[model samples]
Target: MALTVHSRFHPIHTDLAVVTLTGDVDISTAARLRDDLAALLGDGARHLVLDLGDVSFMDSSGLSVLAGVFPLLRESGALALAAVNPRIREVLRTTGLTRLFPIYTSVDTAITVLRAGDDAPS
Candidate 1:
């Protein structure tokens, strides 16, 4: 499983979109991720769960793509990361981005957490 990027649709109890990062996400693939995120947003998919368990490597470029996407999703309050790799997690932690996004151990947990948020009185 080299680092690659692919997306899948996950129709859970609520609207769920799963984007899985497979291969290395460096400068080479950063744009692809960005495009994917933008496409999802354009398609009216506010709820996005990025599954990063298959990613073997990532760099600033990859991080930038995520940073860009987070705000877009936040505008609608629907986005999360699921099963993020430890290496990527470490990078995010070191950069203090862990607090910027909601991360969960799995997509199921993410959905549960998001659903809870939806149920909470604003």
Candidate 2:
């Protein structure tokens, strides 16, 4: 099955956009993923989190989408991955992107971290 992505915006202390993915993320849906994510970034969403707990499969194409967004997110100091399964994490690790971004075990963790960062004194 092809990947289906559902995106929603949550009003956290800091601006955040969460996109949840389900089904297989291969060549067929990688472009959609890229477009949707890039749209979010374009809309001024700085803090982004992708919840991939429901994604059954992913490929290099999916990894490419993630990688392509990282630098753009970094340019504004935002973006992270949340609720990624071990299988996908392995792929991210193999791509040497594991340390490039913060990986959280759950969406709650991602929100908490974001909230904390927002609350921290600068």
The best candidate in terms of TM-score: 2
Q: What lDDT is obtained when candidate 2 is compared to the true structure?
A: 0.83
Question: Candidate 2's residue-wise lDDT over 1-122, tens digit each?
Answer: 87888987786443588888999889999999999998887777778888988997888898888888888877655677888889988988888988877899998898778767877898
For 1-122, candidate 1 gives per-residue lDDT tens digits of 24565666666533557787777888888888889888877776768888887778889998898888877777666778889888889998998778887789997898778778877997
Clashing pairs in 2: none
In order of appearance, the predictions have TM-scores of 0.88, 0.90
Per-model C-alpha lDDT, please?
A: 0.79, 0.83
For model 1, give the 10-residue run with minimal summed lDDT. Answer: 7-16
Evaluated at residue 108, the lDDT of candidate 1 is 81
Query: For model 1, what is the C-alpha lDDT against the true structure?
Result: 0.79
Give the clash count for each candidate.
5, 0
Q: How many Å off is the CA of 118 in candidate 2?
A: 3.0
